[model samples]
Target: MVGTAARALIVSERRITGLSQVVIADLVAELGPVWQARRDAELCDRPRRRAVGAGAKYKLVFVDRLLATLVHLRHGITHDVLACWFGVDRSTITRAIGEIRPLLAGRGCRIAPGLRLRTLADVIAHLGATGQTGIIDATEIRVRRPAAHRRGRNRFVSGKSRTNAMKALVVTDDRGRLLFCGEVRAGSVADITQARDAGLVDLLADTVHLEILADAGYQGLAAQTYGQVVTPPRKRRGKNLEQVQWLMAHHEQARFEHSSRRIPVEHGIAHLKNWRALARHHGHRHHLPDTIRAVAGLLSDQQATHKRKLAALPTGQSR
Candidate 1:
């Protein structure tokens, strides 16, 4: 257990870290022995320098490193602040981030396996069995502009936000649990273009019951793909939608209904953005994809934890 002052400096349990203290403690309980073994092996890799008191003990323990990394991801706090918070050197903070990020990313990537809807048969089997579906959409993460002389500076400037950013696709179950994320691309890339390049369209082509919910930016995706795709109906400029299109209450109302089901993807994206690092990354832009994937994995783990708790509750109990 951490001291009160240390707990105050670290993230609050009320905040999202992809894992609560209960979950994180459970994880530590399972991984602590393995991590100590790995640390021993690493130490064995180098012979000890016999000079007395040459190397001092690390300020933060292994569990602290893990906690600190999650805090950084949760709030995008600076390394200097983290060092001060953990009573460690700035380099130690950086090293901890580098080490723990991949583990988190791996956890995020594992969420994809629950989506067994790879083929049309699989999709049919899934919906027929569970009566549920998935949604797909693109979200952008802000990044520093590329160097002036860089080849693709124009490609990274987003038309939507009119700022430099990276684009990624997020897929979620209807309940807003993230299924997949991270086909990270330049901001200027069109949604349909990225969807096709990411093989999202191709994958959906083989699925029948799992619909891909997107905005009209993916207008042509439906024509080129076989799986169900839903989007708001297009409206023409200089003409009111009711007058120029379908009847007064029909078309516009249908779009509203579709949006009701489609709104969950936005919530999923918002959940990811809760990790402010994804909102504005200050590090190497190349690592953005891994960061996004890492966060997605944390979101999945958090969702699973919630589900397990809810399941453990007595039936008919208010959530």
Candidate 2:
């Protein structure tokens, strides 16, 4: 339902989709074939009564569908607003998002063609192989509070943020490039508990070269992983600090150094949150995991492209 002028305007300005023109072009080229193949497979599973071109044509083309989905995820624009922009019904926007989101999620965080990191295990393997230090952290996203009578409603309340929220563990490389985003959990869940539930300890135990830097929230993980997990140094609980000022000063310095190394994860989390879909959720909680993974994939592609550009720049020139 988009008019010719409106479509042209959107095409001319890539910022409407929150992606560079190059990135959007790349996504369209990559997604077109995959989407067509999926539709073909669906037709094969359930034969259409009419021929492929015999039915009513879609108003929004494949590119428009992909653009709408990206805009929604990047800006957190509602289906109603999208409907007005595209001159279509809200259901049209909803259907397009439902169709496109899963494909992006399936692509995962793409470092290169045929080398997407889809799970935590893939992330760990890549880190070990590349000998790069990883930073791990958890972030909370606000969600709608459940009804009073809903079962386990209290589980959604986060003791740290004092709100109804969900928590997700994000893993990034030393330079703050995202590598993986784990599944969402109840906000009330502790950081260490979430890591344990995700089998992070087991994964770290298996790797010899992979090291992860984390904050004080993951205090006990270092011992569990035989020191593969690094956390800030803790002060002696029952010691007379004034009597051992020199030792206390050393511990403070150690903590400072650990924090400096772990700061990149904070930047990574901020980058992820820049996608409004992850900043806050207005949709069903069940849909959040897919959105998170999909956004991470898109962001990773953007970051990878940016890194390539930086590397291409001449020495002594500003990026």
Candidate 3:
């Protein structure tokens, strides 16, 4: 049963991983060596009494392990379900994901060969170098409510979504390609607070030419970044009726233009949420950061592949 399902799914890679066969093959080729080295290092550090190959081998091979992890991340399948699919115990599926997930997260968001943006600094530098305008936004993912006795339980409740959730800041290029997905925060954390805590102001301060387009949630950032952070215009209060009406007209136009520029970030967030694991995290809250970043990295890889194919197409041919 496991063999049949696995073979069928492998033939149709997009169903499981939301990635093409070519992309999966490229990932396996690139990540296999690094995973092997890391495993070797772990074995050496522990100095197992049994020689190499003395213990029972993995029930799922490296490729299967990677595939299983991707499927779980993309679809949020339970470990027991994955175990049934792969013909292994639930513990095996759990261990496999624990191992492979970090590798994906560590890869960050790859834009080109030998260029991966892992941190906010890396994203800032890339945008500056490429002269691409970036769009920034925060999105929330609903999660299981915390127990009454839990410390900081209220922190998980979002004022905006009015649900127990976690939030992450997403940054994307002008064309809606993911550049960075910030660390996860409590749902109660304000978008502006998260941006400031992530050092967006300090980082963008040095990059004179790079501008970040954001929505109204990041209002104060424009002043702090010296106009580098562009946001929708705010209406002036306590003005005469004539003055207020004029300001309102001006603000409406400015807002429309700002929203158009900032729309890419919404698309970026939508793409990130397409991963079931991110749609609503059922796992421990502490693990959400790794899960979100890993999903972002995989999505970025898929986007990069699509872009390359488009570039390769003949003139006027659209995919």
Q: Model 1: which residue pairs collide?
A: 108-297, 120-206
Which 10 consecutive residues of model 3 have the lowest summed lDDT?
A: 1-10
lDDT on C-alpha atoms for all candidate structures: 0.73, 0.88, 0.88
Model 3 error, position 291 (Å): 0.5
Ranking by TM-score: 3, 2, 1
Q: What is candidate 3's TM-score against the reference?
A: 0.95
The runs of at least 3 residues in candidate 2 whose Cα sits more than 4 Å from the true structure, single-residue gaps closed, are 11-14, 237-243
Collision count for each candidate, in order: 2, 0, 0
Candidate 3 displacement at residue 13 in angstroms: 3.5
Q: How much is 54 displaced in model 2, in angstroms?
A: 1.7
lDDT of 2 by residue, 1-319 (tens): 7777876677568567656777778888899999999887887787578866677788888888988899899889999999999888999999999999988888888787567899999999999999999999999999999978999999989999999999998999888888998678999999999999989999888889578999989999999999999899887543675757877788899999988888888898898899999999999998888999999898888888888888899998997
lDDT of 3 at 23: 80
Task: Give me the runs in candidate 1 sitting further than 4 Å from their true place.
Answer: 1-12, 16-18, 29-59, 109-131, 234-249
Please say which candidate is ahead in lDDT: 1 or 2.
2
lDDT value for model 1: 0.73
Global CA lDDT of candidate 3, please?
A: 0.88
